[model samples]
Target chain A: MSSREIDRIDGSALPLRGDNIDTDRIIPARFLKAITFEGLGDHVFEDDRAAMADHPFSNPAYRQARIILTNANFVSGSSREHAPQALNRWGIHACVGESFSEIFRGNSLAIGLPCVTMSAADMGPLMDLVERAPDTSLTLSLSDRTVTVDGQRISIAVDAAVRDAFLAGTWDATGLLLDDFEVVRGVASRVPYIRGF
Target chain B: MGKTLLKKVWDLHTVRPLSTGQTQLFIGLHLIHEVTTPQAFDMLRARGIGVAFPERTFGTTDHIIPTLDQTRPFQDTLAEAMLSALERNCAEYNIPLWNLDSENQGIVHVIGPELGLTQPGMTIACGDSHTSTHGALGAVAFGIGTSQVRDVLASQSLAFEPLKVRRIAVNGTLGNGVFAKDVILEIIHRLGVQGGVGHAYEYGGTAVDAMSIEERLTMCNMSIAGGARVGYVNPDQTTFDYLRGRRFAPQGDAFDRAVSWWRSIASDADADYDDVVEIAAAEIEPRVTWGINPGQSVGVSERIPATGDAGTNGAVAEALDFMGLVGGAPIMGTRIDVAFVGSCTNSRLSDLREAARIAKGRRVASHVKALVVPGSRAVLAAAEREGLDQVFREAGFEWRGAGCSRCLAMNPDRLEGNQLCASSSNRNFKGRQGSPTGRTLLMSPAMVAAAALAGEVVDVRDAL
Candidate 1:
C-alpha cells in the first residue's frame, strides 16, 4: 500500500455551524501574501475569532479537535489552497459538512484532508451531538463509508473517484499525471487549438 | 442526442482514464499569479521536477501588486516578496511573465482575453478561482488550487471527474440599465450560492447572446461564487469579432480556420444537458448583495428578507445581524461610505464606459470616496484615448491604475473599518474587502456610479 493512503481518521470534532462558510472567513486575503503556508494555522478564522467572542475556533473546548463540522456549502469562494493548508496545520484531519464547494473539496482532497458530506437532515443531529459532547471520539472510516460516534453509525458520502484516490494512495495527483506524460503530450498534439489551428 | 461544448472539449483533452476513475486531462493554457504560485513552484522544486511545458504557461503579478504606486519593491514586504518570487519562478521555468512594468499586465483573467491567450475550443487552468472568466470565449476553464497548480506545472495535466452540464437560458431582452452583472447576480439569487455545485453552467439564450464579449466575461467570472467550477457562452460572431486582431489570436487564413473549429465545438442544437434553468431577462432588475455572500442579495427595489421569510436555516438572520441591517428594510437608500468599480468581473473597457456614462457631469457625494480601476493597462490606455479618464476625474471619482485594487484588498487599496461600499466587483463575503467589519454591496458598474453620486444605494435606471 502507498504510504499516503488515508483509510480512516479518529478524532474529537469542532462544530462551526454555518451556511456558505467561505475561504475568506477561513483564512482571509490579507494573510495570503506569504510565500509559504507556514504559520497560517495561527491566523485561520482570524477575523471571525476577533469579531465574535463565542466563535467556535476560539473556544477552549474544541482546541484539540481534529475534525470540523459545518453546515451547507462549507468552504466556498476563492480557490485559495491556503484555507485547507490553514486547517491542516491547525490540527484538522477531516471536515464533515452538509455540502462543500467544488474547488474547496478538490483542494482539501489534494492535501489529504477528507471532506465528506451528509444530508442536511442527517447533519443536524450529528452537529448537535458534537456540540453536546465536544470530546466525544468520532471515527470516520473510508473503508466502511460511515462515521461512528457514540455507538451511532452515520452514513456519509464521498465522491467515488476521491474516495478511490484516498484508498489507493494516489491523492497527490502530480505523480499520477506525470506518469502519463507521454499520453498527455499525445492528447495535446491531437487538439487543433493547441496546435495553432 | 448531441454533444455539449464542455463534453467536446473534455474529450479532446483527455489523455487517459486512471484506476481512480478520473480522467487525466491536458490543459491548453496555464495562467499563474504571485499569491498562489510561490508554494506551487516550491512543491516542484522539492520533488526535483521542472515545468513540463513552460511555453504553455503564462505568469503575471496581480493579487499582491499595489494599485496606487507599483514600484520595484512594494511598501508591504510580503507583497514585494511574493511578486519577486513570481518573477524568479517564471524566469527559472522559462515562462513569459507580465510584471508591473509590462503594458500587457493586469488581472490574469482580463489580460488572458485581452492578449488573445484565451480561446475557444480549449481547456484552461489557473491558480485563481476567477479563471472561469476565460470560459466566456467558449473554453472549458477551471480554477485550481496550489497542489493542482504544481500538478499542471510538472505534468501539464490534472486528474478530474467529469461535471454535469446545466444550461441556464435567459430569454428575451434586458431592459434599460440592466447589465450582464445584474443578470449573473439574478441567476445567483435564483440559484442559491450552492445550487450549481457539480455542474458546469452553459449560459445561452437571446439575452446572453446579446451580451458583448466583455460582458460575457463579466458573467462567467463569478461562476465560482455561484458554486459552479466553470461557466461558458458558446463561441459566436461576437466572440470572433473580439478575437480578431488580438495579440495572441491566430491571424489571416489561420483565424478563419480556427473559427470553424470553434463553431464546431459549440453545443449542438439538440444538445443533451443534465439540467436546464430558464430565466426571463426583463424580470431581472438591478441586483445588489445585502449580506455576507453574493447569493444573499435582492433587487434594488426589494426589501431585505425577514427571519421567517428567509427560511429556517438562520443564514439570512445571521447575515442581517452581521451586516447590522434590520430585516424587511428596503435595500435602497442604504448609506455607503465608499464606491469602487474594478475586479475581473466588471473591470473591462465596456464596464468603464458604462460607469463613465453615469459619472459624466455628476459629482460624487462629498462624504463618498469613489474610485474606478481599470482591469488592465490596455483598458486604461483605451479609456484614456477615449477621454473616459477625464470624465471620471471631473466627476470626482478617483481614476486609479490597473490592478485588483479594492476587490480583494490584497494591496494598499482597501476599505476602512466598517465602511459600507457600493462595489462592482464579485464576491461580497464578510471581510472580503480587507476590513473585518467592512461591508460590500455588489452591483453593476453603473449602479456603483449612481450610488457614488447619491451616497447610497439607488436605482441606476432612475439616475439615468
Candidate 2:
C-alpha cells in the first residue's frame, strides 16, 4: 500500500468569510455533471465568485493560495467528494475553520487534505493576517498541532484519528481497508441479516 | 447502562481495530449513483483492484437523468456520458444497476428501501448525502465520499470512527398539518446546523414512533442537513410491516427469524446516550425556510428573525441579503414563482398524496409554475393507480416522471433566473436549484402545494 504523508502545508491562505459554506456554493451541482473531476477547480465557487465582487477566489492577490480559512460548518451540504476534489485541484492543501461538517472532513482526509479546527477568537487574527497581507505565508504543521503565520503560533485541533492517518500516510483508506479482506468476510458472515437470518 | 442501537450495530459491523484509531467496519450495503461513482471506479481500475463483493453493491441513475423525456441519448451530452460511464463501470464490475428503463430505477436511497434492500442493523453507505434515508428502516446508514466509495468497493469495508449517540425524543402528538418535515425542521431550528457533529442522532419517543415508515424516511433523510452523517430510529413492528414482502427482504420463516434479530438491535430502554434532547411534538408547526440553509426556518405563522436575533451571528443578515427578504416581515405571504415537490426527502407516494390533497380542488395560480416528481418509478405507478397524478394535473401542476428532478437540479428541471421556489426538497443553499440567482424556500410537500395555489408562502393547514 502506497500513500503520501501530509504532515504540513505551507503557503499563502485564502479567506472566505462565511458560515455554513455549503458544497453547492463550493462546486455547484451543474458542474458535477462531468464524468471526471478534471477542470472542476476552474468552477469552484463559480457562482459565488461571479456574484460577490470581493469573493476571495476571484481576488487576484489570493490566486495561488494553497490553504483556505473559513468559519463554522464549512462545506455543510452534500457529501459530494467533488467539493474537496475541486479545492484540492485548486491547490488547497489544508483548511482551517471554526468547524466542519462530518462528511466534508472525511472527504478531505480521504484525499489527504487536512481540515483543522481553530477557535473563532484564534481564527479572527489568522483571517486578518491573511486578508491584511495576502502574500503572507501560513504554515500548518500537523506534528506541532499549530498554524504559524508571521512568527505567531495558533493552536489548532484535528481529530486524533485523522491526524494520525495523515501523519502515517494512511489517509488513503482504500489500501488500509483492502488489507483485511478475510476479516471483512468473517464479519459479514456473522451478521444474520447478511446471511438472510 | 444498556447499549444504544448505534453501539450494537457498530459492534456488529466491526472487522478489526486499525492503527489509525479507527475501526474497519464492514458495510452491509453500498449504494452508488452516476455523479459520484465514475471517479471511484477509475480509482479502482488504476489500482488494479476488482470489486470485492459486487452483490452487496447497487447502482442507479438519478442525479443526471432527464425526467421529462426518458429516451435514450439524453439531450445533455455530458449527462449522457455520465450515465454511460456508470453503466459501463457497473457492468464491468458485475454490480447490479437499475438503469433508467428499469422499473427498479429511482433515486438510490428511494430504491434501496423500496426494494427491501435496506434492513435493520445493517451498515449502509452511499455516495449521496441522503443515504441517511435508509435509517428509517433501522439501518445504520451514512453518506460517503468517492474515495470511501472506492474503499468499500475494494474491500466491502471502511475505516470508520464510531459516533456518539444522541437521543432526540419528540414526545406528545403532532398538531394538525404538522408533518414529519416540520418536526425535523423544528429540530434543526432548535439545534443549530452543526449541533449533531461527531454524533449519530437516534430519533425516537412518541412522535417519531407514531410516524409511518415513509414519514420516518423523510425525517431521516434530512439528518445530514443537520450535520449528522448518521441518524436512525429503532426498527419496530412498523418497520417489519413495511419490509415484509418487498423484493429483497427475507421471506417466510427467515423473516420471522430476522424480526427477532432486528428487535434485538433496538436501543435498550435504559440505553446510555452521549446526550438526550426532549422536544414537544405539539409545538412544531408547518415550517418554511426563509434563508440559505435548512436551519434558517420559521413556523408558518411566525415572522422572519431580524439580524438582531441574539444567536444569529450575522447569518440572518447574510441570508436576508441573499434571499432579498426584509427582516421582521411575516414569512407567511412571501411571493413565489415556482413550486417543486420531489427529492429523496419527500417524493414518496405519501408525499404525493399529501400534495395532491391540497391540489385536488384548487388551481395553481396563473403566475406559479408547479410540478410533482415521484421518488421512484414505483411511487409514480402507485400514484397513477390512485389517480393522484390526475388530481395534480387537473390543478394545473405538471406531473412528471421520477428522478431527483429539481432538488439539486442535476437534471433539466431547474429554476429560472432569480425565481423564488417553494421546494419540498432538502437544502436551500445558494445555487442549489440550477440557477445561481434563483432562491429556494424549503418546506413540506403540502406546503409547496399550498404555495403553488396561493402564489406565495401559506400554511397548508388552511387548505386542510
Candidate 3:
C-alpha cells in the first residue's frame, strides 16, 4: 500500500447514456467469482457490449477513451469492487456524471478512479458535446473541481476532503491506516469485542 | 431535537475525525464470507499486516459452499479453491470460521444475529451488500467493498462520511398477506433505487413497531436495494427480548445493563431527521418486482406497467425487453421456470414456515425447479425440528442445506440459460441468479412457494 494522487485527466470520452447504470451493467455478477480483480477490464459491460452491438464502450471511436460521461445515478448497484477495477483496467481515469452511488464513489476513489459530478443543468450539454464528437478530449482538474472540454469550463462538485486527498496524493486510505498502526491498535484494544488469537 | 440511533451509535464509535472530513470509526463486528474475503486476505498477506482484532471478526463459507452436498473436495474446482482459501486465511489470521460442519455456519447476516453478535449501538461491517441486514438489531451495519474489507481487517476502523438521517414512517395497519417484504418493496417503489443514496433510513411508526425481530430484519435487509448505505429500526423491548439468552449477549445483571444502554441509544421521539417520508401501510400490497431493478415493482394484482405508466419510459422499455414481458399486461400468471426460497433477505425459520404453510399438500409444478435454502444452520435445525423440511420435500421441493444457494449463485445451484425464476432474494438484476440471461422476479418466500406450486407468478393471498 502506497500513497497515490490523481490531480487531472486529459483524455477522450466514452458517453454511456442512461440513468442508474448499475454495477451489474458495469461488470455483471457472473464475472465476480474471480479470486482477484485482474483481467476484469476485457469483460467490462460484458452483457451490454455483447447484447447490444453499438454499446459505447465497443464503439471504435471511443476505443481508447479514458473518461466515462454519463447521466444520473451511475454505478448504482451492488458494492462490487470489480466495477471500478473494470473501469480502471479498461483505462478509465475519471467519470463525469450527474451523481454516483455512495458505495460506487467510495470504491472508485479507493482505486484512484475519480468519480466527479456536475450539476444536471450542466451535464446534458457536456454529455452531448462528448457524444457529438468522440474525438473531443476533456480535462478534469481535481484541485479546481472543474472539467474543461472544447474550451468550455464546467464546474464539478466533489467532496472537499475527497478532492484534497486526490490533489495532494494522500488518498491511499489503506496506506494511511497502516501508517497510523499504533493509533489503530489503540482503538482496537479499546473495543470490548476485539481480541488477539 | 434529539439524536437518531444512527448518530448515537456513530458518535460512540468515532475514533477521531480524519483530515479528509471522514470519521475514523471503530467497527465492533466484522463479518466475512468466502467470495469477498479471499482477495482482502491476500492484500493483508502482500502488505504483511495482521488483523488488528481477530476476535472481532467472524468468517463463514456461504457464497461458494455447496448447499446440496457436504463432502470435501467440491465438484467445482473454483468453489473448492474458494473454500480452501477461506479456510487457510481464517486459520492464518486467527479468526474463528464457522465452516460447513459448524452449527454456527450460515449466511453471514443470519449467523450474526442468531449468535447474539449483532447487538444494539454497534457498528458492523461486512464485504457483502446484505450486511445491512444486521441493522435490524439496531446496529449501523453497511456493506463495504473488498478494499475496505482489507482496511477493516488491518485496522478495525473505516473512514466514513456521516449520513443524514431519513425517517421512513409507515403508519396504520397492514392488510392481510402484506409481509415485511411488501413494506420494503413498497418503500423502494415509491422512493426509487437512488432515493436513499446519501441517507440512513430510520424505519419507524405503528406498522414497523408491530413487526417481529425477523420481520424487521427482512425490512432492513433490503436497505441496499433502496440505495441507502444503512437502515435500522430503533432498539425496543422487542429487540432486547430477542437478544436475551443468546450466545454472545450479556447474561444476568450485565444483560440488564446492556439493555439500558441499548435503550438509551434508540432514536429519541423528537429525533431530528433530514427528511421524513410517510407511507400508509393500508396502501401497500403484496408487491413483486416486474422489471430488472427493485424499484420497478407493482401490486400483486396490478398489470405490468406500460412504458409511460412506469414513469421512466426508456428504462421500462429496456427492462420489459430484457425480461421478455409486455407492458400493460397483467404480471400475475407470468410463467416461471424456477422458484428460490432463500437468501439473507428472507430465509429464517418464520419465512420457511410461511412457505411451508403454502407448500403443504401442494406439489411444485413439474416444470418448475424449486429449492428452500435456510439462512443459517440453526434455522435449518429449527425447521427440521418442526418437520418443515419434510413438508417441503414431500411437496417436490428440494430441501437444501444452509447456505446462500441460488441467491447470487456462487455454488452449483444456478439457473440454466434464459430460465425465469421467482426468487425471495433482494436483487432481480439480469443474471443475478447465475445464468447471464436468467431472469429473476423478486417476491416474498411465500409468494415464491406459490409461484412454484402454480407454475407461474400468482398472488400469494389467493393461494393462501
lDDT of 3 by residue, B1-464 (tens): 99999998887777788878888888899999887778898988888888888988999988877887779999887788888989999999899999988999999999999999999888999987788889898999979998899999988888888899999999999987789999999999999899999899899999999999999999999998898989999989999999999999888888888888888889988888999999999999898899889998999999998788734668888899999999999999899999999999999999999999999999999999999999999999999999999999999999999988898887889899989999999999877888888999999999999999999988988977
lDDT per residue for candidate 2 within B1-464, as digits (tens), equals: 99999999999999999999999898999999999989999999999999999999999888987878978888899999999999999999999999987999998888999999999999999998989999999999989989989999999998888799999999999988899999999999888789888899999999999999999999999998899999999999999999999999999999999999999999999999999999999888999999999999999999999999877668899899999999999999999999999999999999999999999988999999998999899999999999999999999999998899899899899899999999999999998999999999999999999999999999899999
Error of 1 at B262 (Å): 0.7
Clash count of each predicted structure: 0, 0, 0
> What is candidate 3's DockQ?
0.51
In model 2, where do residues sit more than 4 Å from their true spots? none
Report per-candidate DockQ: 0.91, 0.91, 0.51
Whole-model Cα lDDT per candidate? Answer: 0.92, 0.92, 0.88
lDDT of 1 by residue, B244-330 (tens): 999999999999999999999999999999999999999999999999999988998999888888353588888888888888999
Candidate 1 per-residue lDDT, tens place, A80-153, comes to 99999999999999998888999999999899999999888888888888888889999999889999998989
TM-score between model 2 and native: 0.99
Docking quality of model 1: it rates as high
- Give each prediction's root-mean-square deviation over alpha carbons: 1.1, 0.9, 1.9
